[model samples]
Target chain A: MYAFFIRTFEGSKTQVELLKEKIRQDGKVLSEEVLKVDSFLNHQIDPVLMQEIGKEFVARFSDQNITKIVTIESSGIAPATMAGLILGVPVVFARKRKSLTLTDHLYSAKVHSFTKNESNDISVSKDFISNEDTVLLIDDFLANGQAALGLIDIAEQAGAKIAGVGIVIEKAFQPGGELIRKAGIRLESLAELQSLQDGKVQFVGEEAF
Target chain B: MYAFFIRTFEGSKTQVELLKEKIRQDGKVLSEEVLKVDSFLNHQIDPVLMQEIGKEFVARFSDQNITKIVTIESSGIAPATMAGLILGVPVVFARKRKSLTLTDHLYSAKVHSFTKNESNDISVSKDFISNEDTVLLIDDFLANGQAALGLIDIAEQAGAKIAGVGIVIEKAFQPGGELIRKAGIRLESLAELQSLQDGKVQFVGEEAF
Candidate 1:
């Protein structure tokens, strides 16, 4: 699938490498015991890098004519909004919890967070997405593919076509990449981590680990 | 205070008018009920417009060196992230709900949402904000000022300095604009609403509506 996108002048290998290099340089480990890059992913949104990633996603799926970019909010809004800017599309973020402001007619699905170790409800406003629209799902990270699956569920409920799913980083060794591949949806990731050992970041197809 | 910022940059008035015009033109009403401006605010983050707003913010507070841009989750992230980008600073968004991935050590505050019609908790990671940081609070709306106060409380809990607050829209008739002003803090709003009556948008000044 990546080969297809790359061959069609839709994707760039060099830009992906640049994002990986940025993740290595600016991303810092928040805790020694728990290896989490809080600076980039959790705490702050790096606009410069995020904008580049957004551009890459737009280039990769430029021909799709996406009507809306759907994402699970809190962290995903940053990159999703960036992608929406480049794609010139509206972005509808799923709320993690139900609120009075949210309409009763919502498409909801349960998402399990591996890092958080809990399951939460994710939902979208039904009016924002429609059967005539095509959606491109964006997220910050894909470890177990649960969040992506939850987003796909919402998209399906709204009867919107899934153009593709763009992820900033994917843990290749985890079940996420394989599960997404088996689901038959187009998945494009900027960085793939083959392994993590001794608090070091290792890339796929590399002997760095 | 706005005059001070306006005097620093002469031509910014044109850009401000441009934004106000964009809001009036692109903004749509859903069934004459909800103001659905998802194209620019909630769903899509307009890069050009957001950049202009960010520039206006920088021009408004150029004298102060903002160490961090603090905001709440959801709608606030877009404008805050854009401002952080132009200011070349990091943006720290307060989580509306507690997640398992977040550490227990946090600065928490309560926020009442008029749109949502409920009160919820907002928090910031202790590690992201510190005592020495100077925070510039940013939000998409300042209708009631509860959200801004929530962020300010979080910043205060971290012992961070409150440089000032930047808001995209403020309902002048509401107590929000008045409360923030009485608190003796500099409040800068891109657009001030005199009122919303008969499904029409009204501006506070003759600048634009």
Candidate 2:
């Protein structure tokens, strides 16, 4: 039993390391605050890598009893759907609209995009989520956490229980990570970047390597 | 050999029928031209159904020497990603931008959304697609064919070979299907809607039922 446990843990570790290696190879540092992974994670997606990512998310949140997977539209859809496939749950993506105010028959929240410097209303249809749901929130990147907070707000508006927030990449230096943990929400990030300064990636636990 | 062919054909037909049934059951017709599949297609996604879709796209487009899968942002990402997972190809989604004119370092095309009554420039980084790639274009809906044309335009701009176009649902009454076919492009739509008059869906071949 001990041997089996060790093997499983090692396997998990290797899979996650594969993701980090990909980020190291193909990921480009655009600026001190911006890292471009458009070739794989967002714009051009590697399906095999995304499959591994889904498996990793399932392994981490296996104990959460998640009923549904929620994410924001466009980039978040691929990873969220992959996780939903493994979890056997439906995935819902909040639509970003140009509207600044609430609309009828929708659970809405205003989310500001720091990168784009714009505020847009993100909304989910009222018919999809309800109070009975226990949802797992997923996104590609966690920077300022504005999008995550918006999803959480919508879930709260619908009275749905949040299992946790799963992020593929987290800027460890950003206030978003600290703010989420302080709120007592279980947050799991596959990769945590300590810094993106000087056109380099310094992952938060890389000193051990 | 005969039985094997029959079995494969029957299996493919049943899977396509499943998608049509889902639309007939949950699809809401807001008007003559609008069908809301928010419950399972765009806003909320059914992973199991999407898996079947992925398999089906592979089955149909297996003959095309497809090296890449191209799709538009938002709705098309889920199904396109699933297809990419099966085909072992990288999926690239065209990011919709507000810019009207061509931009630097990207292949851009103007696509007008008839549903929203607006125009947006869809772009893909020049680094993603090249002359060596034989790309299969996929989308959730084919109405006016503007988006599909935009993708084809971008692919041509990148000098990529066009393998084919795959669509989840096609409005048969609309001119998009005819326009694409007239251009000598192979267009495969899983479900075709003949009419949605009086809030009732009429699939093109439903009379056989």
Candidate 3:
């Protein structure tokens, strides 16, 4: 039972702005290609921030009839679970490893991690995802879009309709955002980074959206 | 801001009972040793139930002066993040892999997954946990206690004081519960299973608690 607050989304700094501000303040610029947000996103998480991100995701994708929230293991689980909490949907995270319990009747795809330069098979039990479900895919970061694409592949394998893709951070300089958009899938990246070059953080700018 | 409800913890089914009821209704007993709860806990998560689990954990450990909530990757991240949100603390999940950005100045521990029949070197960045902190370690399931012990080892390696350990479910037949209790740390397992033999879930029961 939630008390409804008549809070409008106008005349205020958006959740996207707050997330970008947090990134600017705490995100580590490792190089032009890498930005480490270990302080709040991946390694160590700020739960309040995650909850805010979740709300933002739900607001952005509210139009879609999302029956389930699908995400990859580890980082994606936090924000996905949070959004699933608010939306009253189940969250399924695809495991990168072949766990002993998950033996058969699975929908799986190979996700190539560009950072680690290795391919890992990510899987979802067939019992979780099905053709009748319209799934909203979520992830912490979208770089080359390998993980997102892998999720899409898995969802398609189950003959499920994809509602959209929600990403916490999207590197605009990379091909991920373009690829997803070109594929005619709805993609919402909360903080779209233009560049992490010159040991500085640069956003794609608010007007670009 | 939350509306304060002074609801007493009496004259109602306990959080543990609710969790056990859900388990009994949905859990699949693969054998006497394994109870698959993928429908709600792991693989696929029930977000509302996870939030309840989080609140119960916070209520149980509210007096511990906890500064951080720590857990392993994947399954543990969801419930741990939920607890972190309620407690106003950071949830630091130890990475099961040596990620590219996570190279140096780390606290590492080897966790052997009996299910996978393999060992993974789980690591945490040195920047997260410290001696000044008191961490509450959380997990979805406690079987052999290998994962919990590994977390304790990592937290101890950083000189962080162990406030307590919280588990969503504990196989009372397993050594994990006893091992943690013998170490003199407060252990709160929401649902304790007495047995899963012959494909039936038997709880340790409310009177035992």
Candidate 4:
């Protein structure tokens, strides 16, 4: 059994610290490269805690008039939906596979998952977002930024203005953080992990949360 | 654009009636066999409407002392997470595809999606549920009972008590409702559709909800 309350950072009291604590305690680290939060956030979810993560995202991006929040299918839907609830906005997730029921008119983009070693097309209905909409993109983890870029591509296709991006955990060790910042997208990550050294999780921008 | 009623169902009569109204108005019928609620529920999610759906679910299953709300990954995560928020319990979704980070210890099940015309292995981390758990399964739609049956099987594998089955929409024309009811599962669907015929959605037990 995983002891979920083990705090890694003794004095760091930010949401980032608490989140890192949860990861260190409950997250299953299959390898030095793969840190799975399936026990708490993705596969096995803690909604009450995730809802707090949502409020934290809103707290960070409250100044922006985010009319809609968009995320990719599967894991992102949980926290992003919660953020939509806290923000009083709607949430739309891009479908990874085209369903028989989905309409033909859609904004499609290609996303390559570095972790999965696979590439696929993700799409959103053309009618869900429009030119007037200001959308915030949110996701569970940002590693390679392929999925977030796909979301950005879809939002731009709909002519919607990019409000910002919210990420639950950012692997700053990867290119996602760099690419997003390089693109000038206003991105806020609740917990940013700098490295996983000898089964220990390190952090970036500790004071910024 | 999909018109999201900026009213987060506030001052709305009740979740059931509001959900039905939204379905009647915004739900699309691509064919007699296909009824798509992508505009509001599945594809483009309305957080306020979904939150109310969660509350209505809790009202239905409140007395059961549900320990965990279980769902399949992807679309089910949205409403299930909200229900967890309302119930103040944790949520767990079975993963459709095994990722590298997933643990080898798991309860596996095969689910055939009637919509997708594909069958794959869906598994949940064995640690997520146990013999003491009373699990409640929630999903976006119940047409074949195949998916829910898979979940039930997984719960049973964990020796967890079956609290009940909750569905957002049930295609009554299909055998899913009867099979679940016949098994004596306390099956509750917010909206039960009798048929989707001639570009129309017919409902059974409408007034009861």
Q: Write the per-residue lDDT of candidate 4 for residues A59-171, one digit (tens) a residue.
A: 78878888999998788888888788767788999888633245479898888877767778899888899999999999999989998888988898999999889999998
Q: DockQ, per-model, please?
A: 0.32, 0.52, 0.62, 0.50
Report the lDDT tens digits of candidate 1 across residue range A45-158: 666566667778888988898988888787888778767766656777887863334448788888887777888888876777899999999988888899999989888898
The TM-score each candidate achieves on chain A is: 0.85, 0.91, 0.91, 0.87
Q: Number of clashes in every candidate structure?
A: 1, 0, 0, 0
lDDT of 3 by residue, A28-122 (tens): 89988999999999999998788788889989987888999999888899999988987879999998963334557988888888897888889
Give the candidate order by descending DockQ: 3, 2, 4, 1
Q: Worst ten-residue run, lDDT, model 2 chain A?
A: A1-10
Q: Which stretches of candidate 3 lie over 4 Å from their true place?
A: A1-12, A98-103, A206-209, B1-12, B98-103, B206-209
True contacts kept of 2: 0.88
True contacts kept of each: 0.49, 0.88, 0.91, 0.88
Judged by TM-score relative to the true structure, which candidate is superior, 2 or 3? 2
> Who wins the DockQ comparison?
3
User: Which of 1 and 4 is ahead in lDDT?
Assistant: 4
Cα miss at A56, model 2 (Å)?
Answer: 1.0
Worst 10 residues of 3 chain B by lDDT: B1-10
Per-residue lDDT of candidate 2, residues B1-209 (tens digit): 01121123235457688898889889999888988999989899987677677777878988888999999998999999988987779999999988846588999999998887899999999999999999999999999999999999999999999998999999999999998999889999999999888888989968522
Give the TM-score of chain B in candidate 1: 0.85
